[model samples]
Target: MTKPIYIHGSGCVSVQPTFEAGYFFDHVTSYTQNPVPALDPDYKAFIPALQLRRMNKSMRMAIFASRMAMQQAGITTVDAIITGSGLGCLRDSERFVEALRTDEGSLLNPTPFIQSTHNMAAAALALSLGCKGYNMTYVNNANSFESALLDAMIYLTEHPAATILLGGVDELGERTTQFWDLANYLKRDDATIPTPLIEQATPGEIATEGATFFVASQEPGDHTFGKIRAVETRLEVDAPEIFISGFLQRNGIEAETLDAVVLGYNGDSRYDEIYRTLGSSLFANLPQIAFKHVVGEYDTVVAAALFLALGIFQRQHVPQRLLLNHSSIPPILRRILIYTQRRGQNHSVILVEK
Candidate 1:
C-alpha cells in the first residue's frame, strides 16, 4: 500500500478574495458577458521588491502562493516542486507574440521569451527557496493539475519526500479573452437573465484564471487539510456511470459512504448532464456543491476546487454559496469527491478524506 498523501497546507489566489480573508464568499460574483481577471494580492507581503521586478504576473502569484503554503506547513524545504498551467505567463506570452508580430520577429527581448516557458513559474519558486529537488511542470490543458497531482502521488511512494509542493497556475491574456468572447465562449452581459453556462448551455464556455498551491506531506500534521486518497484521469470514457464507478472502485470508496460531492458545474448546458448523472444517481442524497459559478471556468479550475475542499475541512461547514442541495448531513465532513472535465475530455476524479 502507498503512503497517504496529506495536504499539510494550501494557498490560493483567485478572482474572489482568497489569501487575506478567511471566508468572504458570501455573495457570488457573476460576469454575465466578459471574462474577468483575478483579484491581485499584495505581492510585497510574500515577495521582495528586487525579485518582484524580475518576475511576471504568473511567477509572482505562484511564488506568493507557494510561500504562503510553506509558511502554513511550518516547513523550510520540500523534496519536490511540481506545478501545472494551461497557459503559463499569459502576460509574457502576449508581449512576446506581439513583439514578434509588430517587429517582424526582430528586436524581441529575451526576458519575455524566457518567462514564456511553462515551467518558469515553478523554476522561480525552486530558485527562491534554494531547493534543488525534483521539479516538473504539466501543460496538458484541463488535465494539467491532475497530472501534477498523480505524479506527486507516485513520487511519494519511493522517494521518502516528507514534504512536496504542488500547484496549478494560469493567467488570462487580452487576445485570448477577446477570442473567447468572439467565439461566444464567454457569457454575455445581461443582468436580467442567467448566463448560458447556467441556462441555455453551448459549446462555448466562460473564461477565468487563478492559481492554487499546496504543501503535501507523508506524515499528517495538526493543520493537515485531508488525505488525497486517489486521483485518476482518462482522455476518453463513457458518461457518468463508468467514470464514477471506476473511480470509486479504484479508491475503494463506495458511493453510499461519500460525505460530500463537489461538481464542476460552470453553468454550461452542454456538459452539465455529466455531473447531473452523478448528482442525481450516485450522489443524490449527499451534500452536493459547485464553485464554477463563483470562480468561472478555466483549465485549472480543479485547483480552486482543491482549495475549497481544504477550506471545508478546516471550517467544518460548507459555504452556503457552494451548496447545490438542501440536504444537510453531520457538520463533520470526512470524505469528499471532486469531479471535473473540460469539453467532455480530460475527465478527472480526486478523492480526499479526513
Candidate 2:
C-alpha cells in the first residue's frame, strides 16, 4: 500500500508579498510589461553576508524559502532535500554566456559555471542543512515540481520517520524572456490584460518566476496543512474529464467530495480553454480557484499554487481574487484537486486533503 504524506509547513517567494508574515495576496501586484521577475526578499534575514554575496537570485530565493519552511515545521534538519526547476539557474547561465561572449570563451568565472547546474539548488540546500540523505532535483519542463513531489512521496512511504524538504525554483532570465517574447509565449506589453485569467484573452500568458518550499512527512502533526492524497501526471490526455475520473477513481474519491480546485489558468487564451472546459463541466459544483494570473506562468509556478492551497486549508476561506466562479461554499475545506498544464502538455492532477 502507498503511504500518505502530509505537509507540515510551506514558504513562498513570488511577485506578491508572500514572504511577509500573514500576507496572502491581500494586495495584488501588477505589471506594465511581460515576463516579470519575482520581488526580492531581504536575503540577509536568511543567508549570512559571506554566503549571500555569492548566490544568484534563484539560489537565494530557494534557500530563504527553505529556511522559512523549516522554521515553520520546527525542524533542525531534513532527511532529504528535493527541488525542481525548468531553467535551473537562469541568471547564472546568462552570466556564463555573457562571460563567454565578452571573453571569447576564455578566462571563465568558475562561480557561475559551478552554480549553473540544474541540481545546484537541492545540493546547496543539502549542504547548508548538513543533510546527506537522498538529494535530488527534477529538471522536467512544466511538470518539474510534480516530479519532485512524486519522489518525496515515495521516499516518505518507505521511510516513515523521514521528513523531506521539497520545493521548486525558477527564475526569469534576460535571454529566456527575449526568446519567449519571440515565441509569443508572453503577453504583449502594449495590451492591457486582466489577470488570474482572462476569458477574453490574447495569445500569451503573464510570464513570471518564483520559488516555494514545503516540508512533508508520513505522519501528520498539529501544524500540518493537509495530506496529499494523490498526484498524477500525463503526457497527453484525449479527454480531460475521463482522465480526471480515472485519477480520482484510483484514489477512491468521488467528484462530489472535492471542496475546491486550484486550476492553473495563466491567462493564455491558447490553454485557458483547457481549464474552462473542465471547470464548467466535471467540476461544475466545485469552487474553482486560480493563481497564475497573479503569479504568472513558469515551469515551477505550481509550487506557489501548493503554498496557496495550504493557505486555503489553514484559512478555510477562498480569496476573492482567486475565485473564478461562484459555487456553494462547502461546510468545511477538506479536499482540493489541483490541475495544471503548460501549452496543453505535461498535464498534472494533484489531490490535497485536510
| Top candidate (lDDT) | 2
The clash numbers for all candidates, in the given order, read: 8, 1
- RMSD to native for every prediction? 2.2, 1.4
Q: Can you give the TM-score per candidate against the true fold? A: 0.94, 0.97
List the candidate 1 regions with Cα displacement exceeding 4 Å.
Answer: 27-33, 191-203
Assess candidate 2 and give its TM-score to the true structure. Answer: 0.97
Candidate 1, 231: how far from true, in Å?
Answer: 0.2
lDDT values of the candidates? 0.82, 0.87
Worst 10 residues of 2 by lDDT: 190-199
- TM-score of decoy 1: 0.94
lDDT value, residue 194 of candidate 2: 34
lDDT of 2 by residue, 129-168 (tens): 8999999999999999999999888888899999899999
Winning candidate number (TM-score): 2
- After superposition, which runs of candidate 2 have C-alpha atoms over 4 Å from their true positions? 190-196
Find the number of clashing residue pairs for candidate 1.
Answer: 8
